[model samples]
Target: MTNYKRKKLDAFLSLSFCRLLSVIYIVHLPHLDATIEVTLRSMVASTFSMEYPKANRSFTSMSHLRRQLLPKTKDMPSGTGFGLMRLFTRKSPRSHSSKKKLPAGEQESESTTSTMSSTETTSIHRYDSGRRYNARQDIPYLLPNDEEENDRAHQQHWMINVAFGSNFDAPVQDALEKGIEVLDSGCGPATWTLEMAEKYPNSTFNGTDISPRFPQTIKPPNCHFFIHNIVDPAPFPDSTFMFIHQRLLSLGILENEWDKALADLMRTLKPGGWIELLEISYAQYENAGPKVTLLMQSVVTYGKSKGLNPGAAHVLDDMLTQAGAVNISSRRVAIPLNHGGKLGDLFWDDFKDIFMALYPVVGRLHSDLADIEEYKRFLDACKTECSEHQTALYWYRSCGQKPSNDE
Candidate 1:
């Protein structure tokens, strides 16, 4: 062969050898056996030149191939010899971290979950603070998704029922008894779903949340859980529900998204199906002192930083009306912070649960308190002030019906 031809062949062979090494290194990763090294050396020798026999060839090419093929793994610890093979690794689709790609024709799952209880569970994607929650690029809920939060939600449920004196204002029980379908948006722990499913065995309940915090080990036959984002177009077809319910989504819903949220609710329900939205806000509440107000203001500020309007709950009356619902009724249920006997105690626990769960995030996000201890002291003082002044917050429950054909 001409010198030029031999040189070109040698270069091509060098790269081919590097590629072969790349595959071998990846396949046998942290530990390369003697057999693999000998095979690699033989392949390199045979492919590159006839001057050296396969077995007698100098194995100096290993160092050369390492230099030519591998990319540095800065984040990875040293001495694994995986640095060069890292170049062939694929970046994680979401975070650009080093990861292995699944074999051809295989697709990754959306989420994976492990359960500790039938009432509450956690997905692999969960991020725990005081409670478990999954961080998403879309929603900004801070609470955790464990059994404690689940029980807390159940307690809150009772407190809400006591405050309102009924499970619902609209004839949801009537619809359910007739074997209708129900969709519970942001159904944390599926407490409402389980209860309603047992109460109305004929009705099917679909619960959805961004986190896999729903009951898994034990669930009613009619109740199902779906991981979903309410801001997006719901998975179901338009007008599929008989009754759609949502509560306490104010943590994620923003001022502008209210219109979209209401619109989505309207799109989700059948004609004349009732939609009840319950939200808690600081609008026109009584007796919150500087510490309480400060904590509340910090929450509002932190929510705004995340592009949410914490106070948007107060404006749902207009938004719901604009979304093309008729016979809209708004009920503001007052929850005594420190005044109403056993009811007040439950509400206090509910409030404290939220405060405790969010306390860490609040300190990081917003703090009117001086330090950790000061925040604790402030909370203790708020409890006293609440009882002395009959401090209470209002839960605005607004029910609306889609306009029927007759309308």
Candidate 2:
């Protein structure tokens, strides 16, 4: 072959190689392995507009190609090698040190480490202090005690009860059979306590909340209600109770606050006792009715705007696992939140009826409810839907237990 033709063929091969290298590194290598090699490859491909596949071959066959294209290298590029080397092996300015030591007068620069440590300590203290302030301010709103109807604690209790439905009865039976005593932290209105006491007279149930919404007339012999705020540690002694249950408490808890709360619950449980937690993970909804998804999305957005944790839905599993809970299991229940299910379907009928009763409570709580009229129309449609077909709302239930023996 002529020198000119061979040179052209080599040039074409070089371009093809560059493209190949770029693709493999950019799209494939990073996924296959998380190493400094992939990072370096990314730097090269991104810094230069060289296609990845071509770059891959150029990188692999560089030694042989370098000898073949010696004449072209001199005329073709000067900074390419230096650029690639710099990209592949970056040096930190902060890490580099000068050979010359500091003068005696400048020896105090060593204390910069101490200065940074002190600054970090101060920053952490300030952050914690700010959180304390926010929590205190939020407590009154989160756990309001006023009895004039539509109160925060009342609404939360109702929401939780409706959320659990028949599943609540099963747990009460299980706890009773297991001879478990319950400390219902942040309990409002003593609904579960009252019901459990009636159903399981042998098992003891204690309900505590910052709010004093305990029903005077609904008192049961086996059930007791108290006032306690979980912002501080629970007042009960460690390893005392058999089972502890809490639900629908995300509004009152910030992220990671559940750790101390769970630890406290575990501490309160006996060695062989269980602790059950049920949270309505508001984010997991599928096959939602027409306005349900929109309303849910709006509510989630508004919750975030109001400084609530929209991510609270999925954090419970991690939180429970982190808190040393064992035998963790979760179930996702899909209930249609709209007005389009048959009365013959038990879950759907109850779901529609509950939404009709509860959406007004939600409307009272949220000022940004433009769909109030639409909600009513949907309720009427739900009534019609309930008579015709089966549809319902849904929620997720996750439960975990503390270890029987930490040893």
Candidate 3:
């Protein structure tokens, strides 16, 4: 046999032996002495860890394996098997020499440093139906991260600007004009961040997202991007920014995660700093016809399955208040779709792109939309319905301020 085949055979034989030993130990665990039981457990854990590193093993799969191999016993501690698996599989901490030192004048607090270091490992991206998606298993962001999506993001930014008449509504224009730290959470492609950075050169802008779609080499001097996950703690020190902007994260953040996500954003804001959020009322379009409504219903059902709230826009104000934000205010704009001429056409196109991107997700939930051709036809029907019914989508922009220290 070839060397590769030999290695495969050896691995298979080793795994089979390990399984047999595990079965035997579990069956005779009650009769075995304490030291022998511990030794057997250690041996099994070490073998598993040696065969599969932590990165190769998912917590869910490992938990399932633990359940299959070990039953709850009065003698054994709860979660003993799971804990042993984790302990053996845990990777050693990186040495200080391997750690990247921050640039001068960019020092971070210990907590922020830890958060940044944890995100140093890049997530693997997945491709389906010729579109790329983020590999963050925890997040349910059902959108492509490829160049086509970036172009759509750019178009969406301009459409929002036209609809709202400005890039932002917060009263941080003067601070931005002078010089202050700013953050753009969930900034896909960094369209708004790059534009704002160019418009207000005095202020420094930092954008963070799980995907690295933002510019790296040709970005403005004032703009910076990081491959950071927003669901986790913000990778910046407390009270770090005068302004924090997050938009279009309704699809990405789950309903239960919104509170923690907002809390983290608030944690990173300076005292009395403004934090703004913009989101479209997903699946809540006005005057939607039958076809449009059906498509939206599928989207809502898919979102609910993933623990997401499709109508997060309507509750932004309440969420901010619960996060302890003060001076909370909101603005809602109903942008016409397919009937408002140029802006409407732009929105229609953007909506089409969104629906097309969600094919992989909605297709699974809806059999009629399983095929791309059928999906396109459904989108065409929705467009005709929007044009006929004068459908409009509501965009919500909410702003709140961090309480000043004295207050």
Candidate 4:
């Protein structure tokens, strides 16, 4: 082949190889450690830029391709890896160490104050056991705030919808259809919020969580998200929302804090509006195997040590009644795991993810499975036991209405 043709062929082949590697890395990004991911991105960007110095457009196109191909959850952050990709193209700033230090007794300037705030915001999330968790000491959430957990939350949303045959059981469909204000407290990932917003465009929906894992961009006009802990007082004014919903916060709310949390929900709820809460019966699985029982018991013991109520679902009715709510009602559903076909399979996967995410705490609480690999093996055994024993999880949906002024 001529030199010109040979050079062109070599360039094309090199570019193709780099593109293949990019696709592979992107496909496995969720499973990769953060350090490994950064290394892989750096390698790809360096190699691609070196071979195709004038191909910056190609690199940008690759970013778009990656965004499109990655599995999308309702709360997937937009332009997730684009910022990392930009690091390769831009020049690094001078080291802060080289700057003059502030004199003693000298307060930081506005710019420095804003920079520190940004740093603190980033530090709100910390990594443990390869999972990203909310680092705020006040918010006692047990799950990780990472994409894997978001995916699991999304799956759990659909599973609950199917099991209960609706997103909610309260008698607020007419109000929602006609346009009403709704709150989804402790709304991890905002999966349910987004779905409900789309279903009832007239209704406005607000989602709040301690972690900012919900989608920042790419949400319906009626849907909004805020970073607020429900343990604190309600951020909204009194009687602001026509309906309030909270789910699965049994792990986050302390046993003694249940009254306060419910009171906060009731405070934001409009008089005569409905408040609904859905929670799993922690450590109360039916037909549990020996291994399953042991693991669950460990979870309950660990939760109790933190003052969390593992059996919060059982007392929802009494709590609502004490909170001055009227017409309280509760429903129960049994979700089969590992034996009920597709629904069971989905629930099993969700359970496994939960187990994996709790490793940091469970491993410490149970010394026998301190090593992660061994814990995983133990998890596999639990899965087998679940299938053999026909394990089932129960969920409670409790709802009540605030008394109107005339009442």
Candidate 5:
């Protein structure tokens, strides 16, 4: 095993360290067979691709790769993870590169792993044990691929459904019933997609997320799930979807990236297709307790410090309009904390969903939060405050439509 010090970690936080650390963590955590070294090399090389012979315009540049790899570094924009390299490392004329030699024993192990991986089933490691993701492209998503996240997504769908009084608040609900193509961006656990698929058998549903948290088996015939990053151009060609629904992107998107993401979605959407973005804001509500306010402040501050936009939901409508969508509209669903109503109960659970994921993200970025026990008391205190004081938070739901030729 490699002995990594804080210096190693610091450089790793700046370099393509998380990608390497992912392999290390996976190797040590699991009873990895010969396949470990092969998978490790592939993932590592994929992430740290300095072998580009020409300038690849797909990404900003090679150094952009390094910035993309680490989100929890001190060198990044304070509290947020939006810092990519301004200076790019241009590729040299030569395609062939110098390969670093490994130890004799390590080389033998890697060689053996490669051979075994080819002959046997191509098994990929799943991060079901915790909230850690292995792939570099999956950095935007913060939630773990565990059953807890699966259940949390499930519960969240139920809460959203009950809160909105419908599965979706889009105007095309009628079109959905009549049968049309629908896309669920960032469809975590596939709960919303699955339920909607079952409900509207006529409508075809496609869901995409970086995390393979959704079950591949036991899905409806009309539904399909793909591992996709919403920030990139969607695999689906232009005018493929009649309706596109994205939920909870505010939690993951940086302040500056939503425009590109919105443009990508607009391109994939058909003329007159409806697009909806739903998010729960971390900003201050109409009423908030001291503990709750403190928690929100820390979350918002830490996120901005890293360059993420915790308040993205608050500005989603503007983004949709900026994307050149027509008929843009929004609704803010006020959720009172434990206000002796069923809705309050649902909002309370939603708060659980927020803080449950929030703790790990902040902990990963800041050392002081490594032990989340402190957050537990804070959550408990906030719960009591909600129950007693009727403090509230809001869910922002916005929908728009692509311009039709006639319009």
Candidate 6:
């Protein structure tokens, strides 16, 4: 098998094992923070089979990863993942051409260093078991072609189609036609960016992330990767890109930085180009049901304890509008965190739903957390609320265009 394939297999195996350990740890550790760390170490160990010379390296590194976990705060600013799905999902964006090739060895070293700086560990080897693990862990989740699940997810994606239809497709398609430059910030494993590059061979697709886990490839002369933190100044200059895409970046970015990031991204956009914002609000509460609302609050409080505030979703639309994008609007979608009449069932089901959905793509890109079952009790309560028809999840999707000022 190719080295890449082998690494993928190793990652799959390691993640599966750590998932099992997480199931066990959840029973012992009541604290979400502690359990998340333990789960991360187990998975990392599975990747790095050989014992490191440093006895506590895994533990220390896991802590470092935790610090970077940036809690999803209220009104957390949007990131690249949210940007693409909102702005560029319907079609490929325009891109510039480049034939530059960083040597294979040099590229691998850069990726390793990048991962270490974020997690504070110098242990991952490129093309070794750990790197392969990264590849494997990302592929299945983002591109799961299971016709049934894709249908379900596509259905969810489509619910917003009517509300944001033209805004979503036109810019990406326009960019592809014009060879405009595109940026995918916080791109996890290049799922969206790489797919776009393959579809639009004439355009350049730039993917930036703190981890160097992207595939080192001989680009088709139109794609590249960079290590950048989106909250900071981007690498490119003003009006350099035709489009910028950011999604789910709530953790690392603060509220004040939203305008700055907006200005920075606008500087890169060509006249009349597009920018998209993808976010999920955390501010859900029941209207009248007493018991159900309390249970909802408890479940939501747990998320808040982990630094996730559902309220951020509500604020992003206004922020994007204030930044001066035209035709700005947002759609709210609900993912049933609980469907049945049991709290354990509700929380556990949604927890597993999110894990099963995202783990294949990016779970391993970050640290591992609690077991699928740990949230069962919570899910059951949520289900009861849902059965009473008192449960709701408010997720926000918003996008806008840079005015064609030159026109």
TM-scores of the candidates are 0.67, 0.52, 0.69, 0.72, 0.66, 0.49
lDDT (C-alpha, whole model) for all candidates? 0.65, 0.48, 0.73, 0.73, 0.63, 0.47
lDDT of 1: 0.65
Residue pairs in collision within model 1: 70-84, 131-144, 132-144, 132-145
Candidate number of the best lDDT: 3
In terms of lDDT, the poorest run of 10 residues in model 3 is 51-60
Model 5 collision count:
9
Off by over 4 Å in 2: 1-136, 140-175, 338-392
Per residue, candidate 3 scores C-alpha lDDT tens digits across 292-331 of: 7776787788888889888899999999999999998999
> Over 4 Å off in model 1, which ranges?
1-131, 365-370
The TM-score measured for candidate 1 stands at 0.67
Distance from true location, Cα of 108 in model 4, Å: 21
Q: Please give the ranking of all candidate structures by TM-score, highest first, separated by commas.
A: 4, 3, 1, 5, 2, 6
**Compared to the true structure, candidate 4 yields what TM-score?**
0.72
RMSD of 5: 19.1
What number of backbone clashes does candidate 1 have, counting pairs of residues 3 or more apart or in separate chains? 4
- Compute the lDDT for candidate 5: 0.63
**Residue-level lDDT tens digits of model 4 in 179-217:** 999999988877778778877889999999888877675
Candidate with more favorable, higher lDDT: 2 or 3:
3
lDDT of 4 at 198: 71
Name the regions of candidate 5 deviating beyond 4 angstroms. 1-130, 134-138, 361-371
lDDT of 4 at 342: 61
Task: Tell me which of candidates 1 and 6 scores higher on TM-score.
Answer: 1
- Candidate number of the best TM-score: 4
Per-residue C-alpha lDDT of model 2 across residues 1-407, encoded as one tens digit per residue: 96535544564665556456544543453255446555644443344321122222232122212223233334534554423322222221211111222223432221122211111112111111011111234452222232212122322343444455643522346658656677877666555565555566678788887656665323445677776777567778888787777766665665546677777777787776666666555565554554554445554555555555545657667777887877777765554433332112333433433343334334534444324455556656654543444334445566676677753
